[model samples]
Target: MGTDKRHYKEPKTLPDKRNKRPPKRFRRWRLISSSKAVGRFPVLVETIFVEAIIPDLVITQISNGFLHGKIPAAHLPIVDRPHLLDTVVLCIAENPRFTAPITNVTAAVGREAILTCLVEDLGNFKVAWLRVDTQTILTIHNHVITKNHRIGVTHSEHKTWFLHIREIKATDKGWYMCQINTDPMKSQVGYLDVVVPPDILDYATSADIVTREGSNVNLHCKANGFPMPSITWKRETGEMIKLPNGREVANVEGNFLNLTRVSRQQMGPYLCIASNGVPPSVSKRIMLVIHFPPMVWIKNQLVGAYEGQQVTLECHLEAFPKSINYWINERGEMISQSNGRYEPLQKSHNYKTYMKLKIEHVSQSDYGKYKCIAKNALGETDGTIQLFAIPKPSKLLNGIDNDLQDQAGSLLQDKNYVNTASAASRKFICTNFLLVLSALHRLQ
Candidate 1:
């Protein structure tokens, strides 16, 4: 045995494969294939999170971190940790707690909004902030994906994730989410309620409206604010509005007010009010103006006035823009203001006007057609009246027989008449009158 042991050379310790010179490619392959850390990169986390797989790739990722202990858990696949899952029923008992709750946040326009999500034992996990309404991702851990420059994000000690939104807008009011990357991913929702007073948009809403009568009136109103303000129209004068079809209303609901066949009755200041239960309800006053041409009417179109007597003519007119109202003769000449002999008077009440023409001593010249004229920049119109003379009565005649006898004797005395009346023709009329007078005396 001593002699055999002397021959044994310590089994010439086999060359250590690790220390031996190997092919570069084989060494590189071994280095890559053997490392659990490197192998971890190829596993798709989304698939593991969505579907079940052997070894629970998420657990494996947590067990073996990818980038050698960088604080950023991004390098490690986000997966449901077994401990949190194991604590499910017990979680109620322990309530893997939140350091601070995700609470309701209120912010004004052009201001900053901060939503905080803080938790304890949030180990080896990620927090994501999302908008509940749109399901929009606002923040993920330390990253913010919102394209708006006003959006930002921050985190503290891997336990708190904050979503900072700058220059908030009216549309930014809604629910938000704080999510933890875990199996059955833990999530908490927070509401971000934005508040803003109402504001009117130019060019979109209505201004002062100038339209003609018998035309369609389109009044549009637009507004912007948080909580989505509604628009309503009301008359500033507190009067009811009459629709085209004779419907009367005090307040109309909608952004657009359509009144067909508008009339002067529809003219006034209309208030467009917008309110969303926010502070300071706002309103805009738009004037609805109506315009039309002048018109004239003569109540007494014809008149019979005795000669040398005073008579008056009258007319009524309605016009906007304050018409130039006056009287004209049949010749179409504007009657000039004269002495008491020819006078014209006018009195106005809003759109209505009264006109009168007085002739102190009415004559044949004043008896012809007369006109009342009304004119404005919009248009002109006129109405006419006519006058005539009444003839004077004759005085009662006396001594009718004497006058007849005298007239007959004068005719008989004319030599020309005697020659013209040949034969017995001249006696015919004379004899007939004499016989009629004798017969009347006998009857009496």
Candidate 2:
């Protein structure tokens, strides 16, 4: 196409951009002009080109923003283009970045716990700690935001943010988030696990138990703590334990202890131990008291001896609350241990008692029915024994030529009692008794 220069019109004046009206969104939020002062020279504000107008872009207080970029190659040829009066130059600070990741924390009750959030280039941004479960803000920058006194905040090098919790409790266990305030908010979360030791529940556990002997008994114990505590049972006196099935065990390993055919031997303090592999394992002590009536049985109910010989009468007594045991003569008078000639001996072990009365000279008065009595808090019991005289023998009385042996020998019988003597001692008793039975004589 050939160019025709005929009737060409030249514009007299260009449209003035100064009279143009501003956009409606710029009326509420606008930027002012300024010149950036370099170290030695000044950067002209007119050189700033708007790369983009971001809608509703906010950085801290900057609600409306304009992205500044280098001038395009096509814009250099336009000499009379519109001038940009929006001169607010922004050198935006860096957004907070987590330099160190949040590590999972495990804390004990009543101990101090710390949560750290290390940020590298946190220029004007802030670091805040918020509870993930409760959504409660704990700390903001170097200042604590929550109402809790146990929560605290600290910072170092204006980057590392630390949330220090003092005297941590079990309720503080959960996820905690570390947040940074930037154009688009950033956050990281870490878990807090709180551990506690075992604690015994006194109101639920058994106390001093008082029951009758030969009755079945059950002991109960309970406890509460973190990680679900485990309970065990043990006898305080370290005696063999009698289980519910009539079996003996060294220790019981559960919260409940069953004792079958209970007796005074199983009566004492019982220990209830609770643990969960945590610190401060705890134990509770309970007392088991048994009650029963007094019981008495004679070892030797029949006795025969020579006139100048010594004789001993024995009785076995068993009772709870320790039975008071004594020996009584045929006249119904209790024998006195203070008398040297008529000695009464007593030996005790737990609920068992042994009572014996020994007379130095077996006179006619000592050869009668003797009684042993026992009394306690429950009731009383007694047993009787008989003393007999024999006639003198002629030949079989350990040598008839011996005059004293012919008229003084007699036979003694232990009334339905088991003899726990040695073989030699039993042989000696048999020889003397058989030889002396032939020389017995009754004396009125």
* Candidate topping lDDT: 2
Name the regions of candidate 2 deviating beyond 4 angstroms: 1-65, 68-92, 145-147, 154-160, 297-314, 337-347, 356-369, 384-424, 427-431, 439-444
Count backbone overlaps in model 1: 1
Candidate 2 local lDDT, 85-167, one digit each (tens): 33222333333478778998987799999988888867666788999998899888878878899999888887777889999
**Global Cα lDDT for candidate 2:** 0.69
User: Model 1, 219-334: lDDT tens per residue?
Assistant: 99999887788999999989898766788998988899989998876777999999887778899999898888987876555455556666778889987777998887888777
Q: lDDT of all the models against the reference?
A: 0.65, 0.69
Off by over 4 Å in 1: 1-192, 244-246, 302-313, 320-322, 336-351, 356-368, 386-444
